[model samples]
Target: MGGVDVVYNPYDRAVNDDPYPVYARMRTEAPLYHNADLGFWALSRHADVSAALTDSALLSSDHGPLLDPGASGPHARTFLSFVAMDPPEHTRMRAAISRAFTPRRVAALEPMIRQIARDHIEPAVERGTFDFARDIAAKVPLDVISELMGVPPAERAGVRRRSDALLRYDPAGQMSDEGVKGILSLGDYYRSIVVERRAAPRDDLVSALVADGELTEDDLVAFLFLLIGAGAETTTHLLCGAWYWAWRNPVQRAAAFGGAIGAWVEESLRYDTPAAGVARRLTRDTEWYGTTVPKDARVWILIASANRDETVFPDPDVYDLGRDTGKAISFGAGRHYCLGGPLARLEGRVVLEELTACVAPDYDIDRSLIRRTVHGNVRGMVSLPTTVKPA
Candidate 1:
């Protein structure tokens, strides 16, 4: 840790609130710093982070660091979802879901997705004052995903609550005991849904998985769990990221509303990615940036930091909507690139378009009152209060 002061605990609240400065320091001072307390090596530079993510032979995601150490054993076995699986198995599971997530399939949902966003935003816009995060951004994705997954509209609230609970992690890197229990319960609920779908298949993801005989019940549950958890949560953060940027830069907001919102969304993804970092374990001994990582060592790829690497992006701290560096690691890279990237982008574009079209340009957004989740893994606003004029 020559050039930087290494902090072992990644879950510390202060660190989660604003990790860029620390990441910048690390990238400048110690690009490959090993933390003894956390027992993981951190890769903060753009080059190193990119390399670590793509180097499957060296940095493997098969069985790496658990986000919540306390829930290791049970969570390890239960949470062996596709995200944790290596190739061959990962390829198979990914292939099973690929048909549904293809660009055409996702693009087709644009109209319906826009309608969903309008449905939620129209009412809130009429009200003129509401928590943007809760009322607008958060609600849209859950409804769209529910429709996509064929989780009947009535059961959506339960599904959202359970998914939120399961993903809840504190600043101390610990999950609520109740959250773990809720995850198991969710798994059971999805299992029953799978059984029912088996009896009579439908047109949703659940039915599709059930129709694929190659996937087991556990596999189906794990896949769905990943969908609900990552799918909903990441989009939620993108929404928050949009608002955060708009609030900070009113000029950028105006430009965004003037038909260039897509760039704003992309910049937001780079500036404040939902998943700040991803974990992997070294499968074989490897040397990077003059440091040798022993086999079996855990590593954290600092995605948010890489996005802001000074060597990569000019004036990295500033939020420039027009800057098209085309190198942000927000969706990651290589084999493990986010499969739902198209879906997430569509959701973000729809929400921003609908909101800006109906709401006034200078809508009142309270930046100071905004609240963010304390968890390190998922960075998103918990609440965003704002006022907008009705159409």
Candidate 2:
């Protein structure tokens, strides 16, 4: 395959839908491609991506890992949480909340999570035709995070809207002034909630953090903002990705629905990862694939590309649920590996399992009409429409 340019805009709708072909070209010709347009280095091979993710000394996630040259606002600095922090600080902050995000804790919420999924889907199951993204996928993460944070159920919709707005970035350029303001507004709102949680003391994560004094009011709010920002949209994409993947592969979908759906979900994650790329700043000059990346140069590790590397994954283009690739980097790796991974997986499995059980027998998904989100960082369907047989 001929090499393609790696300097494409991430927000471009065309790139979001079919970046694989381009990524394939990059892996073949420019495994360590540098994008002058974006002013960052891109690593497309599996080894390079895995190395960059684990090399905290050489590559740091701090100071805006996603190559946003415009995120240098006061609010951005204030809202920074352990996600951007490295080493001892990251360990400390992560340890504080580690117990709450364990597999056991996430599993314990299975009943409640399943209940939420059913509540969201039951209404749509009867409708026969509905927007799966808006009506179903979008609600699961928002509801889960809101409930965990003790945000009033009634207020979740507003919080979701605010979070969506805050995370929005222009693919064309840096975030707009208004976008920065919206993010700050979200921080302020969460700060106030944290203060309230401190006063009242509840069983929620926010309350626990405040009561333990491990986090101040500001820290608690920022942490919640981080959780909501990191945890919600990624899970949203995972569901949408699953829906799109299943719609395209009915036989596999049938096999998945048969019994081993968890494996299917993991496969979907590897095939179409929600977090397509992660950025890290080069803390020291490094040689990647024989190319010298200068110190302070930003590197974008294309997780989607690495996941599909033909060398690492046989028949990388094809979706195989049974392929035991031994822990894909879809949830990431090393110290910054996602803490909410178990929660996201459980949520995906429950929702997909329930949806497949309830609707797969009755509905024919319209793959052609499925609309994908126009964002590079997240690969997902914006609207998945399907026709259902009457009950």
Candidate 3:
């Protein structure tokens, strides 16, 4: 189909529902695809996407990772924080954040996270029928992140409501007015947390940031927004995809219930990565597969496509739990590799373990009720109706 025009528009509703087929065509027909009207070039091949993610010198994230027209340029740092930073600035901020968001800290959260998973999964499993996306997949991760950030339990739902709004897009493919409101509301909410922590410190991430004093108030607020925006949202989507895919591939679901849950989680991540792609600003005119992308051009590193590249993944479409997905760029690569990757993995694994242990191996997904998320960047179900028999 190289002779035919390959349209890879993220804003198209049909493409948002099922981007895999379009991604496959793009990978074969135009590994380095460009859309003049949209003003962005896309890389679908595994090598190109991976190399581009790691090559900060040529591809800068200072423009932000979202495709939102309003989120780029100088304004990015105000809301996107270190994600829109490069080199020394990114390095410095990440270092301070890492010290607070340590492996030990993440490990300490396991019991709380697992408990949160049980709290949600048990209720749904008891009902023997539930919307997996709404009932379990969404609540667990959102609560986990909220708890980590010391958001009061009573306010978590409001936080989630704002988050949903923040990720929503308007008919024009731009951030909707609600999304703009979401940004301001979340920023204000996080800023309040920072202010509170300064007066009366608590045993949470916000308090840690306040004590550290490295990041300014704006930096702290932006970082917290990123944590909830990117970290919580992606994990929720990952869980939703995993639950839906497991029902589709019963054998793998059975295997996961039979003790291969780690493989199940990893494979799900590679098979249906949450963040479809990340946008980068091209720093210089770069040559790729006979095309030269100009400086300052927006580039999309198609992570979902890269994970499914047949050259890298044999029989890329099939969901096989045994497949080695080490090469997958699902979380990203190099400096911008998702800082919350480990925590997300932990959340996924623990939830799956708790879920499969309590519920029967066989569960039915209501195909008619599965509603896909409409955002350009994040892809997954907004609702997945499921019925299960108790173990």
Candidate 4:
């Protein structure tokens, strides 16, 4: 497993389907394997990834965190978000975002999140069968995030479609033309909303951003994209991925329904991570693994691998809802930890609660119809069909 077996080819569909084996081999056989083909270094071990995440001066996020071989950091349009930025610019924007997207604000979204999940799911239960990814899992996050942004109900569906398109890539692993178009469309839509919020502020995230008055127009738009791209898609994947794990393990599913839904979410974040990895660029020449990393080298911190490190979790691949996953770097570490993590967990809890307690307690996942998404980053199903047993 030394040579090609350890190469991290993100574009390969097979790797996306089941990257665990590849990551497992990489963790032991080649922890510091550098893919000259990809022209980037990788950090696979849990300790190294954890350390590099906080080592900002050595491993920088300024050049963005998602990429392919020979691709630029972040995307041309999404370069404004704090996730793609390094400090002190990252620090300043983070403070402004913290001021605007506060804990109190996200907590207020709980009731609304519950209501949104109920509104979308309760009706679908009557159908007996539907795609969970589309009908429920995807809608809950889209509407909740949109509602937080003060987007009207009439516009939520369009927003979801556009955002989904923006994050999708072609089967050949290239970013699609539609994705670029989607980005452009969102930019226009958010700019219009920003203008409206400026003249007459509302009690939504966008209005809050406008009120902050610190972020530039481009930065505001970038932040909005980050919210949807980072939050929506990954969250949708989490719900579906959690379902994939729990459905396969009815015991854990029952446990989650009983009282430990939060634990299930945490395990899902660890067992089947939503965002697979995050990238950081070297600020200057640095020494790692007893070797020198040249300045401007791209270091791919494989969070998925770190979370599954055998040294940390005895049976790394097993989906244990009761597993203690405090040390997992699913939401990242150090200065760039996920700000919306609390909200994400809250949403996950409510979603599982509604599905099991209210909507489909005896539902069966149509595993044959489940389809994993194709993309360079993030891991999730694009379609998950489910049906309730006949009463």
Q: Model-by-model lDDT, in order?
A: 0.80, 0.77, 0.86, 0.81
lDDT digits (tens) for residues 1-391 of candidate 3: 2465888888787888788999998888888888777677889989888899999999998888877665567677776789899989999899889988788998999999999999999889999889988898889988998998999899999998887765675435466676778768888899999999999999998899889989888889989878887788888889988888888998888787898888988999999999899889998998887777788999988999999999989999999999998898889999999889999999999998998888888889999878987766788888999999988
Residue-by-residue lDDT tens digits, candidate 1, 97-134: 78678888788899989989989988888888999889
- Give the runs in model 2 whose Cα sits over 4 Å from its true position: 1-8, 72-77, 172-178
Tens-place lDDT digits, model 2, residues 91-138 = 877888785677777788899899999999899889988888888998
Off by over 4 Å in 3: 1-4, 170-179
Ranking by TM-score: 3, 1, 4, 2
Q: What TM-score does candidate 1 reach?
A: 0.94
**Model 2, residue 232: displacement in angstroms?**
0.9
Ranking by lDDT: 3, 4, 1, 2
lDDT (Cα, tens digit) per residue for candidate 4, span 1-391: 2244666686677888899999998888888868776677888999999999899988878777765532345453363388877779889889998886578877777888999998988787878888989988888888888887888889887877777665764433365677768768988998888888889998888888778888888888888888877788888989998887888888887787787888989999999999888878888987765678899988888999999999999898998987889889998899999887888888998898877776444568877788887666677888999886433
How far residue 89's Cα lies from its native spot in candidate 4, in Å, is: 0.7
Task: Locate the minimum summed-lDDT window of 10 residues in model 3.
Answer: 165-174
The model with the greatest lDDT is 3
Q: Which residue pairs in model 1 clash with each other?
A: 3-29
Best by TM-score: 3
